[model samples]
Target chain A: AQRVTQPEKLLSVFKGAPVELKCNYSYSGSPELFWYVQYSRQRLQLLLRHISRESIKGFTADLNKGETSFHLKKPFAQEEDSAMYYCALSGSLGGGSNYKLTFGKGTLLTVNP
Target chain B: GAGVSQTPSNKVTEKGKYVELRCDPISGHTALYWYRQSLGQGPEFLIYFQGTGAADDSGLPNDRFFAVRPEGSVSTLKIQRTERGDSAVYLCASSLGRSYNEQFFGPGTRLTVL
Candidate 1:
């Protein structure tokens, strides 16, 4: 079974401080990892995907195959960065059930100003 | 272009009652998905549709939960004999064709059983 683990349920950090949200996944084969964010009064949206290897809104996640981790990081946290972050894992492309994503219990990041 | 949209933003029903939630995907999107999210938890996949056919429904909890996309654009999820545990936010998302594309999510319908 493929599963995504988000250890932190709630994370509080002051504005302008560096932030890191931990995520660990378990899958037998290659996996596709992604981070989805849900801001207050808004629907869930894609924040970043590991395959892209690009930062969005200053947030970046690096997939470590050896460690089976895809931790999301930011140089400096801002008020707008506060949201519920979810770590999702999907099977490799071309697999029968890869399109559906398995999301972890989300981590709520509260940026204090 | 418009994003995904769900009808009946909020629904309140008594236990054992039936309910139906609607979703209208973005124009030209052939893949649609349904998810259920409880308080403080991430969304859970329920079903996926490709064009007018149900490509996958392994995530559905039971037979009481069923969905249909006859016209390939609008879909409806019907829950029979609803239980208290069924209360959650039903989210609908759509992508190009169920590949590796980002899914566009709707506002979600909040279902409450009392």
Candidate 2:
């Protein structure tokens, strides 16, 4: 079984403040972690993936295997960053080779201007 | 260069009725996926199709849910004896292949069970 947990349901930060959205996961094998974002009236889109190790839209997330966590972080928050963010996990399980994302409940980030 | 698209942006139906949602993936994409998002929850995988075959249907909640991607380019999700709990946003995504490719998502169809 695989699961992703996002502790905060809602997070608020003023513009230019640093923001961090916590995510924890439970999976037996090596897992791939990803962050997805959905803006107001917009479709869900990929924010960043751990494997890439590259920041997207001024946000970056590092996968910590020892801690079993992948927290999304941004140095300076902008009002436009307000949206729903989800942490997802994918990995091979039970020998059946298929990649399906298991997502967290989601964290709604409100960047106050 | 068009992205994934889903038909009937919104649908309202009564309990015990049947309904279908459609998805049109990007041209040349070989992998299509279906997901459901309940209120205040993130999207949950429902099914995955590789080409014309279903690579995974394990995420489906029950037998009432069924999906098909006959031509490998478009797909449809069907629900029978729909319940109020089935009301949610049905999301469709597509990727060039099933591996670690970035999946492009559609706007999603909002299903409301009355």
Fill in the DockQ of model 2: 0.71
Best by DockQ: 1
Let me know the TM-score candidate 1 reaches against the reference structure.
Answer: 0.98
Q: What is the TM-score of each candidate against the true structure?
A: 0.98, 0.97
- Candidate 1 — which residues are off by over 4 angstroms? A93-97
DockQ of 1: 0.73
Tens-digit lDDT track of model 2 for A44-77: 9999999899989999999999999999999999
Each model's number of backbone clashes?
0, 0
lDDT of each: 0.94, 0.93
Listed for each candidate, the true contacts retained, as a fraction, are 0.67, 0.77
lDDT of 1 by residue, A35-107 (tens): 9999999999999999899999999999999999999999999999999999998797446455788999999
Question: What's the TM for model 2?
Answer: 0.97
Q: Write the per-residue lDDT of candidate 2 for residues B1-114, one digit (tens) a residue.
A: 889999989999999999999999999999999999999898999999999999889989999999999988999999999999999999999998876788899999999999
State the displacement of the C-alpha of residue B47, model 1, in Å, after optimal TM-score superposition: 0.4
